[model samples]
Target chain A: MLLESTEQVSRWHERRAAFAELDPSMRAEALQRQANSIRRDIVRMISAAGQGHIGGDFSVTDVLTVLFNVVLDVDPHEPRRDGRDIFILSKGHCAAALYATLASAGFFSPNELATFMKPLSDLNGHPANTKVPGVETSTGPLGHGLPVAVGAALGSRIKGAPARVVVVTGDGEMQEGSNWEALMSASHLGLDNLTLFIDRNRLQQGARTEETNALDPLDEKLAAFGLEVRVIDGHDFRQLEAAFGPSTTGKPVAIVANTIKGKGVSFIEDRVEWHHKVPSTEQVEMALEELAQ
Target chain B: MSTLLDTAPVDNRVAFAEELIELASHDDRIVAVCNDSVGSSNLVAFRERFPDRLVNVGIAEQNMVGVGAGLAAVGLIPFVCAAGPFLTGRALEQIKADVAYSQQNVILCGMSPGMAYGELGPTHHSVEDFSWLRALPGLDIVVPADAAQTRIALRQAVAEPRPTYIRIGRHKVPPVSPETNVLERGRFALAREGSDATIIAAGTEVSKALEAAEILAGRGVSVRVLNAVYIAPLDQQAIAAAARDTRAIVTAEEANVAGGLGAAVAAVVAELPKSQRVPMRILGLRDFAPTGSTDFLLDHFGLNAAGLVRAVEEVLNGD
Candidate 1:
């Protein structure tokens, strides 16, 4: 009811034609190629914008690509599809990754990524659902997306819709008490259809996350909150796909994706200063080359 | 002298609950969200009627509001009910970003607003909500004065698709406006008409302003009382008319004077031509209230009917 039916049908036709013929291996290969392309786009977006949270963006790129390309049942042309899966980037500072992945998935023209942070641009420093077609909600101040995702999951249940809610959060963003509150409710409500991906890059804006606030032993904390916790290498597309594959049981699943900050680029990976720092022209080329390889 | 207790009083919370339940019965997408405020918000009946629709986020104001925004995003109308202070003060960022800035159609029902939590102290008082929320862009702030207005406002808010904050009064108040008075967005009806001076009041203070108007009438000082239901999209025309037509203007509310109704009225009057401008007096809490009951605190802050009369007299005397 929220979306136009004609637009949805056309978009669904395109998506079905794109994926319906592909076998599982071909789909995985296509998604892997999309992830590399998204990483290159993230580098270009941050470099062109002159400032962005590239570190977390690179850290979350593969996860975003995997979800958008293969996992989430979403239509780019009809972003407001009621029965489609919902994805919220709770750690919204890494909007470059989300925007690039969404664009690569055909939500909008990939050329629009150049408008990131420009005046009157839909691609602001944070993702705004009002301006952007595919963004579920506007998020930037950290620890917001999870709760909204929880609400969406609950809403899907109430409506008896076959939609799944997925929220991607940063490891450092977990320090926000709101996420803990959401974790409590998501477990209490037994939202088996909900999945939260914590991009555990271990590096915050200022310094290492452990030095900042110490979110180690995170799996135990997640398990304590009554979630079915799984730790996976975020860069591994196969692992990411398996984790997001199916609901194991009653409780919701929280996947702690152990990812390196600035994953694809050799010089930028795991570097604290790369948090929101833009890559120089030469550095951008270097990153592109690394991703291309 | 007739006191505030003389008139038969009704709780706006009950009216809000009833109207919400009625609205939800017809619209399946209407959901009630609260942060462990089921009892305080008088949502027991709503929960009982629509158990599946009520989302209790449990002691987390931020999550509750965010969840409300998410629900709105997914095409469900979420009425986020919580105590006034916590709803406005605690989860303000979520209210600003998720609901207001995101332009989500979430109805924020601030329960027990103003000094309703009287003996519970200043921490619980939602006195600064108007000031805090009024600054946000694209958010409607509605403070319904009585039960009838509460019913009307809730029904209207449910029908319209926009982010709104309705302060439902826990304090008892007699219906001040007649059933003929139509309630709309950014419009206020004249509860009492007089040319001598104009008195504007919102929320629980409207009844007190009416009583003050009666008192002023007995003193041969005809005063017009404007019930300010919509605070954000203020009736600038009505406020400007008050300055142009009346000798003086007095703004009153059961909230902080700094950035609330008084400040809103003052801003409008200041923008008018000098000829239309008149001396204005603002009556409300200037600081946090000390320990006391709701009545005691109202008296302590000069928010009673006598307070409006005194403020009007001060503005009239031009002192």
Candidate 2:
């Protein structure tokens, strides 16, 4: 059952308190387990809906889990609180992963997950900020989130609020000139409160990112734009936590999170066709079994 | 209608900037976001008055719009301003997804819209803004007729917690309506009242439309004139009434005939109970304009008083 009402948002505090009791290694392990469950939910969500970007979901699941469970100072109840940290999913194709993570984080009722992409459901293919709690902005088109995050960070600075704005984009998604445009402004304005995580899963819709449009030397490119760059294993919770940690100097942080397109399911891992291809019933069962292990 | 008042030409951007600064004075949450368009957008005074509140995102329009959305997300009212072409053409997707689709309370000010760029050519002219923005859902597109209306539009957009786009004119225009005219959302004021025919005009074309009305009045053909500032949530009541009471309705705009005010008014008049509908004529640019001044282009496209009178006469004669 999902925590439905605003009053039950204290569930976040309880989860935080419980996680605080655990040691560092245990905390990482606990987050890993949470991510594993969320991954299972992603599979079920897309499978039931008969359509989704499952590969990107599996790739970004660990990052979303870490952000919501560990780093972000947000309450599902007061999602619009002036001081709460804001998260934007720029690679909106991975809405399944974001929805599963928000549901797991007690932003809304988990039961609502079953209604995703259905007629009149709040959980569309792209997350809408107005419909879904904890969703700061609606994004389906690529390369929009980072610029908005820059503005949000600026807003926080103007208000003297300590809120941090974080955004996640895809590796293929970086080829869009808008992201670079935002990168320039983000650095020029010195938005230390903004952080960007690129889900560098190597593959795009039909081919490898390099084959489609080269994004290698990604860190150098980001550093050239004056951002503090860090390359980390996207699937590893420890590295994610550290990368999402303190800023380097007064510049914005960019994490080129290296990841496989499909991290958990062995059969589908790194295969270009699985970018948005749904698994067969038998394949679903097999993927579920692999996840169970 | 015989007596005419001489009014000085005023840049709507001045009123827009002044009103914005006035609003920002009391409300610190209001921030001005522009893409290196401070001088053109008339935000120099605003920036000087409140340095921290003015966010110049450089020449990145896409980033400017997205950043405006981001600012609104965290409870700041960002008035995103830029040259009309770049603001609408370069960053249309950001405006769609970040501001409109996400329901961010960001005010997008399209500075120097229509053929206001004059000799700069079609590349700089934002003649397609109306057609492009009218199709987007959850966006209130306002094209203020003159300086006072521009001030009202800015104030209304800031007060209302929703996404709105205002086309602030760089071209100077004389006041077409009284200063006491109550500028409501989606409502138009009657600039001149005549039951014989009605000329519906918006933005910079409004003053010219009134001049056309005066020209028709010289021939003893009375014409009603409506200043259509609110384009998206158009005043259907006024449009329907015009169709019912007037012998003909001629719509004019400094935009394209494809989907601007002409198209909007036609759509309304088409669905109105058939008997009440009158003969209609739409006037606007049909193609990319030739290299010339704003006035030259307006004359070349047949969008001035003479062109409007010709259209109204044609509609009247045809019917």
Cα lDDT tens digits for candidate 2, A1-293: 23445434566567677877888788888888778888889889888999999999989999998898789988887678779998999999999999888877678977888998889888999988888888888888888888888888888999987578899999999999999999998899899989999999999998999999999899999999999999999988778889998687799999999999988999889999999999889988988888873
Across residues B1-319, which tens digit of lDDT does each residue of candidate 2 receive? 2233257888898888889989999998899999888898889999899999999989989999999998898888999999999999998998888988888999999999999998999999999999998988999999889888888887787777689999999888888766666687888878899878999999988888888988999998889999898887889999998988889999989998899899999999989887988889999989998899998999998889999999989998898
* lDDT of each candidate versus the true structure: 0.87, 0.88
Residue-level lDDT for B281 in candidate 2: 91
Q: Which ten residues in a row have the lowest lDDT in candidate 1 chain A?
A: A1-10
Write out the backbone clash pairs for model 2.
Answer: none
**Which structure among the candidates has the greatest lDDT?**
2
DockQ of 1: 0.76
What is candidate 2's CA lDDT for residue B298?
90
* lDDT for predicted candidate 1 compared with the true structure: 0.87
Which residue pairs in candidate 1 have backbone atoms (N, alpha carbon, C) closer than 3 angstroms, thus clashing? none
Q: What TM-score goes with each of the models?
A: 0.95, 0.97
**Leading candidate by TM-score:** 2
| Cα TM-score of candidate 2 | 0.97
For each candidate, report its DockQ versus the true two-chain complex: 0.76, 0.91
- Label model 2 with its docking quality class: high
The recovered share of true contacts, given per candidate in order, is: 0.72, 0.97
Shift of residue A14 alpha carbon in model 1, Å = 6.8
